[model samples]
Target: MQFHIPAGVGEGMQLTVSGKGNTLGRHGGINCDLLVVIQEEKHPELERDGNDPIYNLNISIPDAILSNTTEIPTAEGRAKIK
Candidate 1:
C-alpha cells in the first residue's frame, strides 16, 4: 500500500485512516480500527544507529589502495566522499 507519510513521522508513530480497516457490520459498527506495524528491512549498504545513518561502503581493491573518492547514495541523493 502506498501511504504518504506526513512530515515529522518517526518510529512507533501511529497513522490512522478512518473507514480503511476491516468491516464490523455484524457488531453494528460501520467502522473498524486498522492497526499497522512498522518493521525495518535490512539494507545492503546502510544501517541505522539511533537517529544517525551508518553507511557500509565496499570499495574495489584498486580504489581503496589509491584512496579515491566514492559516490554514495543517501536519502537526498548521491554524494561524493573521500
Candidate 2:
C-alpha cells in the first residue's frame, strides 16, 4: 500500500498513519510504522571536530488491524474481477 503524507511537516509535527481494508464484507484497518528524522544546521566549529548532527526517530504502528462484522468484497465491485 502507498501513503500520501501531508506537506509542512517540519521540526515538531505529529505523524500518524491509518487505513482500512475489506474482505468478504468484513472491514479491517492497520496502523503503519513510521520514522522521523531531523537535520541540524551546519556549523563551522562542528566541522573542525569531525562531528555531524542528525536526529534519529523510531515509531511503531498503534494498531495492526481492525475487524468489522459487515461482509465486503476484497476487490471493488465496480471493476471487473481479474
Candidate 3:
C-alpha cells in the first residue's frame, strides 16, 4: 500500500493515525490496526475512531504489505518507525 505524506511534514516529528481499512480475504473490510514506534520505543498506538485526527508525519505502513498490491506512494518523511 502506497502512503502519500501530506505537505508540512517534518523530521523527528510525532502524529497520530485514526482509521485504516484492509481487504478481507479479497473483499473490503474493517480498517487495520496502526502501530507507531519511535526510535525503538513503542509509543502512540492508534485505532479507527470517528473523532480522532489521523496524524501525518509520525506514521507509516509496512513497505512489504503496502507494495504487495496497494499503489500508495512511499517516500522518506522522517525517522523509520517499526
TM-score of 3: 0.22
Per-prediction TM-score: 0.55, 0.21, 0.22
lDDT of 1 at 57: 79
Tens-place lDDT per residue, model 3, 1-82, is: 4445454444444544545444345575656644333332222533223333244442246755564332222232333333
Q: List the residue pairs that clash in candidate 3.
A: 1-66, 2-72, 2-73, 16-55, 20-31, 21-31
Per-residue accuracy of model 1 over 1-82 as CA lDDT, tens digit each: 5556675455677877667688887866777656665555656677777767788778899998888998997766689987
Which prediction has more favorable TM-score, 2 or 3? 3
lDDT per model vs. reference: 0.72, 0.36, 0.40
The candidate scoring highest on TM-score is 1
- Assess candidate 1 and give its lDDT: 0.72
Ranking by TM-score: 1, 3, 2
List candidate 3 stretches off by more than 4 Å. 1-16, 40-82
lDDT, residue 65, candidate 3: 50
lDDT for model 2: 0.36
Model 1, position 26: C-alpha lDDT score: 80
TM-score of 2: 0.21
